[model samples]
Target: MRLLQQPWPLKLIWLVLLGEACAALLNREWIVGAVALTTFGLTLLPLYVGRVSGVHIPSGFLVAIAVFLMATLFLGEIRNFYERFWWWDIVLHIGSAVAFGLAGVVLMLILVRGERLTAAPITVAFFAFCFAVTVGVFWEIIEFTADQTLGTNTQRSGLMDTMWDLIVDCLGALVGAAAGWIYLQGEQGWVLTGTLREFVRRNGRLFSPR
Candidate 1:
């Protein structure tokens, strides 16, 4: 009978499990899954739900997960995984870095400018970059562990690959974070009112009456 007052207990558990499954599916990572589950369930859910009350999903968090997953899956540490050689490997890393950078920039723009919702856009972007850096570190650690424990059939030079990956990761994050900061510089937050007005005035053919 006492539990009836907090029916959220049941629903919360379900959300936790759901988030864990999503994290695993997205990153193919178990630890990330565990973190995702706890954060979404314990922190993200109740706070946002109470703040917005009646919303089902934390849509923005979902978007972040999606971006992270896509970047992780396709970017860098390819072919011998630890070896640095040839053009295609470099190309793959560059592509991954660009994709990740663009993803961060686009997400921040949408969150800060288009949606007008954020947890301090600059701070969020910074922390996101930091997280990306940490991820780069973890990638090397995982590789080393795999080499030692699971054998090095797919592994190669940890030092070179790790260093290059770190560099690429930082560069990507810096570029992306800078773009987001520029896009959201002031209080009005990336408004294009003047630009839009000028466009409409010149293109009277399109919006003349329709």
Candidate 2:
């Protein structure tokens, strides 16, 4: 009952992925099955990490990430959304970069012992932007490698696709960094600040001064 009441959206997404995995395996589509199963596991990662690290991750954040993964791994890759919709790849790249940028902010806070009061917002934002860009570069590399080895068309128009992805990634990272900057400026009322504030609140011992 408690599980049904909380994070039901995530649970529903997980179930759908699981069903896809099972159906794919039954149809002898090994690769599709593997991808669906992997996505299902990825959805569980946040809960697993939170449990292991004693962190309290917001359910909304978890659901958002799960939905993103389902869109990318299952719908985009498996359902040929990238081929059907010209904008699908671009949207996913932006979404991923923004997520990575926000994650980078959280990492910076952890590094600074959550001392946002003393830490420089610009420095944090810069790190987040860099971190997101770096991740985007790595993803492009992976796409290149997969196209070369697995004969996948993930890169689509090759150079042009990669360039556009990087450009959008930078744009998304900038947005995320700007949000982080506002969050660090004590704008607790901001929508994005809510999750970060909750994280800090739940892990006060980890963030509090020594």
Candidate 3:
């Protein structure tokens, strides 16, 4: 309810989900339809968690996620972009890893600021990297499961594909972690530090010591 009341970017995510659902249903792709709907529903959980925690999630963040879902689920899986464009999956995997890594850093900062934990800058960055890699592993597990159970070729080249994906994920995560470390050192990158500043400004309570 609250999510729907937000601005157009948030609403756009739902609209994309609905379109994906309709496309899947029309094509008789039950698995795709179910995953699309389920993922869309699951995306709301983050906003709910943020609101409960007194964090004002930015519209750009929601829109970024929406674009990711559109590319990954709708285009990659349903439209077979993975097969059509050889680099599509690779690009998405790298982007997802970086995004997750940045999110992990934000989460760590929130926790530390909330008096829940303390850590050195390097430690926090390392945690973010690990968090991204861990998510990547879980995603690969999902791909494996889907390939085995639903007879999908999400794994592509099987072991080789999984290995490469993990490697790329790790590399992307490292980049994010490095950027975060630099930011912590009072340096600025337009996207990373700018976004962090905006996030902190919007939810100062979460980024302030009690």
Candidate 4:
């Protein structure tokens, strides 16, 4: 309820959900409706967790995540962006890697604040990079399993496709990890980190022990 009062996520939430509903009703694609509802529920998980734990996540970040889901699930999976656009898969892989990398940094920061872990810039960056890449690899595995068992062509070009995806995921994670390292070190003139700092400020309690 409180989340819906926010501007960005609120608007997008209604738009996407409504769009999905319309598609489902008009096109008789019950799967689209189910996926849309499920996506919305999953999208709310972070905010729900943050609220319960006294954490504050920036609206922009949440919105960005929602948009990513929109692109990945609705546009890519439902609309067949992967088939219609040659570069769609590549773009999504890079975006997911970066998102996951940033998420790793956030989790590491929280752990450090909670005294559950020690913080070192390079080591943290490496962890973030590894975390993102590991997730990407797992996704590839899922694709493989789905293709083999469910007769889906998610792998597209077999080993070649998987390798290229992993490569892109690695590259994107590297960039995100570097950014996270620089941001934590308080390097000046960095825009993304600046936004992160602002996020921390707005949600200081989230980064500090209760």
TM-score, per-candidate, Cα-based? 0.39, 0.88, 0.78, 0.85
Show model 4 residue runs off by greater than 4 Å. 114-118, 203-210
Name the runs in model 1 displaced over 4 angstroms.
Answer: 1-87, 94-122, 153-155, 186-210
Q: Write the per-residue lDDT of candidate 3 for residues 38-151, one digit (tens) a residue.
A: 768766876877778877777667667777877887778767888899999889988889888888888888778847566577977998999999999999999899999999
Q: Candidate 4 residues 31-103, lDDT tens each?
A: 8887787777767877798789776777767777777777778778878888899999898889889878877
Which runs in model 2 stand beyond 4 Å of their true positions? 1-5, 25-30, 114-117
Candidate number of the best lDDT: 2
Best TM-score among the predictions, by candidate number: 2
* Each candidate structure's count of clashing pairs: 0, 0, 0, 0
Clashes of 4: 0
Q: RMSD per prediction, one decimal?
A: 13.9, 2.6, 3.3, 2.6
Q: Rank the candidates by TM-score, best first.
A: 2, 4, 3, 1
Each prediction's whole-model lDDT (CA): 0.47, 0.85, 0.81, 0.81
Superposed Cα deviation of residue 40, candidate 1 (Å):
27
